[model samples]
Target: MKRILIILQKEFIQIFRNKTILPIIFVLPIVQLLILANAATQEMKSIRLAIVDSDHSPESRSLINAFSHSKFYTHIPVEGGVNVSIEQIDFGKADAVILIPKGFGEYLIEGTPVNVQLMLNAINITSAALTHSYTSGIIQNFASSIGMETINVTSSKPSIRHWYNPELNYKLYMVPGILVVLVTIVGMFLTAINIVREKELGTIEQVNVTPIKPYQFIVGKLVPFWIIALIELSFGLIIAKIVFNLTIVGSIPLLFGFAALYLIVALGLGLILSTSASNQQQVMFMVFFFMIVFLMLSGLFTPTESMPQWAVLFNKINPLYYFMKVNRMLILKGSEFSNLWDSFVAISIIALLTIFVAIKRYHKSV
Candidate 1:
């Protein structure tokens, strides 16, 4: 027991004295929380809305005014055909393009329906859809207003209610996902290379030659990193709550429990990598590659259900996917273990398997 404690003390002191790693462990998570949370918003605001006015008449001017008056849109005039404005939208020069046909005013006066083309950049599907829906509502209101003034006719009623996110605030949706990303990056990148770094510095050989058992060495090495990772996790969640005004609609204790399980899986996977690889570079490359692949498929940025069936199959093997789901479920859905047990069991099995393989590999190498 004393020897194990001594190993822990030695490992902790060494890690604490490493100036390069402390900043990354303590400073980077907060920085990413601040910068990414600010940039990764879902709310569509001041979108560049361009107009092609072929009619060039009072009604066209009215249509332009309709778009300009809306808080969501920033209207810009395009001096060409609808196609030209659409190209601008395609190239990301504009978010949306509204076109008024040549006979817009004449047709309105003649009681003939005039066609208006709305071209939107669907790259950001949520924002583009909202912009189109809001623009359509404005146009429908204008049409009804014109009908009431120029003709006596019943207008089609328009009613809108946004679901889930009533305010459509991007921060609310992104905060949970951002926290998942930070956890994965730190876990996969830092943890995987821990032992490999010792090997590079010749300390792994020194430890192997010592009286310390593999279990003692492994536990001692992992304890500090595990604590550091959890600390970063806590910092991220606290910032999410205080800075972004995010809520923990789910059980906070349950969330941390699942997080603990997920961390074991992360650390185990890293142990496996470090055991198999002889040097730090190989560990870094492999860990980075896996982290990228997992993060991309984890639905941190996109919905997993929206992916293709085959891609969803790949997501099943991804530990980060389960972590992402658990984080969001706890933060947004208020989920308990019953809602996340299947994922928990799978990750637990994986963790055990990796740890077993890692120990075996380390034994063979030593």
Candidate 2:
């Protein structure tokens, strides 16, 4: 224990003494939290709504006015042609295009079903879905106001409610995922880069020649980084609350406990990769490879259910997949331990396996 403490002190000194790493460790995570938490949002703001009004009638104008008055959309002026509206979409000046057909006023006056065309940029499916939904609601509401009764198959009108996040704020979903990203960066990149730096500087040989056992050396290196990563998580959470109004509705202890375990898994991977690789570039390349691949499969921005069956099966082996799930579940849903047992078990098993592999693979090149 005393030897490990001495090594821990040495690592901290080395970390603080380095100018480049000091700012990265102490400053970078907070900035990422502030920027990325807002940037990764799923909500659409001020959707550009384009109108190709060939109708040129009171009803067409009224429908356009309803859309203009709605908070979710911004009307973009376009010339009179469906092709013109498509041009607006192509030029990135509009998100959705509304075609007020020539017969729209006649259809409305005859109490016939008026068919208005809506075209959307469906590149981002979530944004498109929302834009479609908001616009459809405005059209429906306007129709209802003008006494256009529609027939339904069922008498039951369901009042759908969004629990946990009533406002459907995207930041609430993204902040936790972004927090996972920050923690992963601290635990994986810094640990890997720090250890590889020592190797490159020829300082690792001095420590390796000592009588210190592998576990002692590995623990010494990991303990300091582990604490620093937790500190990073804390700072990120604080910023999340202050800037995004994010609330942790679940047990804080549970979230932290899972974080501690997940950090072990992340650090172990970095430590092993550092020990295996010969240089910083190798370490960084490997980090980018794993980070992108794991994050893509981790269901951060997209749902894993939407993936192919084999891809979903592969994610079961991914540590970030488990951690991301648990964090969102605990923070947003206020889920209990019972609900998260499967993920907790998977993380623990991965942590133990990664730690064992990392410790076993580390060498002083004896």
Candidate 3:
């Protein structure tokens, strides 16, 4: 225990002495949190829409107004007909084109079926799909407002409510996930390069000849980073609350408790990589490769349930997946430990496995 504390003190001294590492430890995560939370979003705010109104009637005008007034769309006026609007899309001037047919108002007044043509640029399938859904909802709302019985469905209406995120703010969903990613990067990458850096500096040989055991050495290496990562998580949460107005519905202590365990999984993975790697460069490349794979499979950007059956099965070994899911559950949903016992158990198992592997692989020799 005394040897471990001494090594921990030495590691802290070394970390603080490095000017470059200080910025990476403290500054970089903050910058990444701010940028990624805002930029990496699925929500589209400025969808350019071209309108072709052949009818020029009050009803047609009202329908056009609905889209124009929406916050999601930017109206692009075309001089000619539907073909001209298509040209606008071809020229990259518009994302979608809405054509109000010549007898749209007449059909609506006569209680007959009216057809409004909506053409979207399918270059980006996801964006196109969202635009289609948004436009369809607007058209339906417009029809209902003007009392178009033919367009109105059966009288039964579904009471739709968004539970966790009532306003559907993208940042609310993204910030917690981004926080997990930031913490993972710090814990994993720093620990991965720790022993390798010592090896490079001719310090590992000196330490290997000392009386320190492998477990003590590993604990010494792991604890400093574990503490630093928790501090990073705290600062990240504060930034999320201040910049994005993120509300934590769960216990802060619970979030930190899970974070403490999750950091072990990450730090142990790093230590395992460090033990196997001959140099810092090799460890960095390995860390980068695993980081990308873990992030993709972790359900950070997309739903894990939507992944292939093989991917879902493989994600069982992914530490990021467990923590990402748990972080959001605790922070956004206010879930108790009882609700997240399975994830906690999975992370605990992974932490133990990684520590065991790291210890076994580390050789106490020059």
Q: Number of the top candidate by TM-score? A: 3
Root-mean-square deviation of Cα positions for candidate 3 versus the true structure, in angstroms: 3.6
Once fitted onto the true fold, the runs of candidate 3 whose alpha carbons sit more than 4 angstroms away are: 54-57, 102-115, 143-172, 332-339
Count of backbone collisions in candidate 2: 0
Give a tens-digit lDDT track for model 1, residues 1-366: 677788778777877898888888777777888888788766778989888888888987987887788788887768777778888877888998777778889988898766677777888788877776677667777887788233211222244555555666777777887887777667766767878888888877777877777766766666667777788889888887788888888888888777777877787778878877878889988888877888889987888999999889987778889989888878887777887899889888777776677667676243
Tens-digit lDDT string for candidate 2 (1-366): 899999999888988898887688767877887788778777877999998889799988999999889777888998667887898889888999988788777778788876677888988888887777666666776777888743111211332345787656888988899899999998899889888988999888998898888899999989888999899988888888888888898989999999999999999999988987879999999987999999999999998899999889988889999889999998899999999989999999999999999988987666
Summarize candidate 3's per-residue lDDT along 26-85 as a digit string, tens digits. Answer: 886679888998898877678999989999999889888998899989999889987889
Instruction: Give one clash count per candidate, in the order shown.
Output: 2, 0, 0
What stretches of model 1 exceed 4 Å from their correct place? 48-70, 75-126, 133-163, 364-366
Error of 2 at 38 (Å): 3.9
lDDT order of candidates, best first?
3, 2, 1
Best by lDDT: 3
User: TM-score of each candidate?
Assistant: 0.75, 0.80, 0.85
lDDT-better candidate, 1 vs 3: 3
User: Which ranges of candidate 2 are over 4 A from the true structure?
Assistant: 50-69, 76-126, 137-163
RMSD of each: 5.7, 4.6, 3.6
